[model samples]
Target: MESLSTKSQLDMARNVHDMGSINKMREAIASGDETVLQEAAQQFEAIFVQMMLKSMRKAQDALADENSPFNSQQVKFYRDMHDQQLATDLTSGGGLGLADVIVKQLGQTEDSYTPASVIRSDGDLSSLNRNRVYNVAEAQDIALSSQSIRSPSAQKD
Candidate 1:
């Protein structure tokens, strides 16, 4: 029974067609694999697209006539399959760039990355003073003092 559940979880994570499943993220992270991470991110993006399409279909169905042939169960099943494939194709073709963003955020090395729970659990939060900024003026002054500058890189001509 336990093995069956575990196998299902693995299948959910590995199957690109199962856009709604995201149960194996912990496994992917534990494996410490970039390709796995990339695949997971892509799958996440595909899931997002699928959800959007599902919602759009629901909205479209709201005004749909029940007596219409287009509203048949077989038609809906085929339509859903089409949407799933469309989502997968869109993700593979660079998608909405959500996968790239996910990869960028989570692909950091252990040394450079610290989980939020660890920081709070350590109880070394003397740095986060409550009265650090009492007023808007003080906050503005502090923000101005340590303003971060960003340099935009122009593409090569």
Candidate 2:
């Protein structure tokens, strides 16, 4: 289990928000009038595809952020694993397949989420709940601990 750093947690927060929005957009298309649905279907798929691509970029951003302790090599490894999983899923006719890949890699699926980022009744991005994502005692507390082990000067100020 890999503990999420602040940045990684934030990324998860954003990912959840984005995914919720995407799903809502999808649902709206489904519930809308026939002409609206038809028009939205094409635009929605394009936007969803872009959302998937953006998520990949955001994942890398989280791993590379200054607050993260993970090096490029480590991030690359995780990213590659996710990419491969996504590719396999896509090849199997799965759409986007990001949520599954994230779930498989992180063991935290987006749907029915309680911990991490919060969402609205319609599943839109709501205020983030801090307690849900990171805690010192969690098995996956990869984030650098608040307790310092090195000299004060040696740590980042």
Candidate 3:
């Protein structure tokens, strides 16, 4: 029953003019289901993709020949419909990875976020050298030397 609502919401989500999707989004939030939250993120990403397509179309139209039949308003309407469907299809197929990022960010509790720059993609942690032991004596000698340098009275000629 909830899955049907999610599927319908995903469908309606493709059309920006559909107000029911907003209510559906509220329901998803109220339900607090992980699956519904994921769907909501995808739905949002699909809408974002549709808007990007619309912006690209607008940019293309700026250089278009107004006198040509191809640039007609009717053509634009159908093109927008096509773009909406395309956005939906693209989102269903893992999207631009924006939906995944969205879910990952929102799913984290508070202390679990590893900053983007700190996340290594190479699958190598050798650079961190977590197993290396510190030489406490060497560290103490260095710290004392620095302290003596700062307080010249402690430095012997």
Candidate 3 stretches greater than 4 Å from native: 1-18, 111-157
* Lowest-sum lDDT 10-residue window in model 1: 148-157
lDDT of 1 by residue, 114-143 (tens): 889866756543544535535656878777
After TM-score superposition, the amount by which residue 149's alpha carbon in candidate 3 deviates from its true location, in angstroms, is: 36
Error of 2 at 51 (Å): 11
Q: What is the number of backbone collisions in each predicted candidate, taken in the order shown? A: 0, 2, 0
Candidate 1 global lDDT: 0.74
* Model 3 residue 66 CA deviation in Å: 1.6
Flag the better candidate by lDDT, 1 or 3. Answer: 3
Candidate 3 lDDT for residue 76:
93
Q: How much is 45 displaced in model 1, in angstroms?
A: 0.9
Q: Model 1 TM-score? A: 0.56
Q: What lDDT is obtained when candidate 2 is compared to the true structure? A: 0.46
Go through the candidates in order and give the C-alpha RMSD of each one to the true structure.
13.2, 20.1, 11.8
TM for every model, in the order presented, reads: 0.56, 0.21, 0.57
Instruction: Go through the candidates in order and give each one's C-alpha lDDT.
Output: 0.74, 0.46, 0.78
lDDT of 2 at 63: 62
- Give per-residue CA lDDT, model 2, range 21-126, as digits (tens): 4454454445542222322333334346655755776776776767666656687567655654444334333355544454344443467457534333555434
Q: What is the lDDT of candidate 3?
A: 0.78
Output the number of the lDDT-best candidate: 3
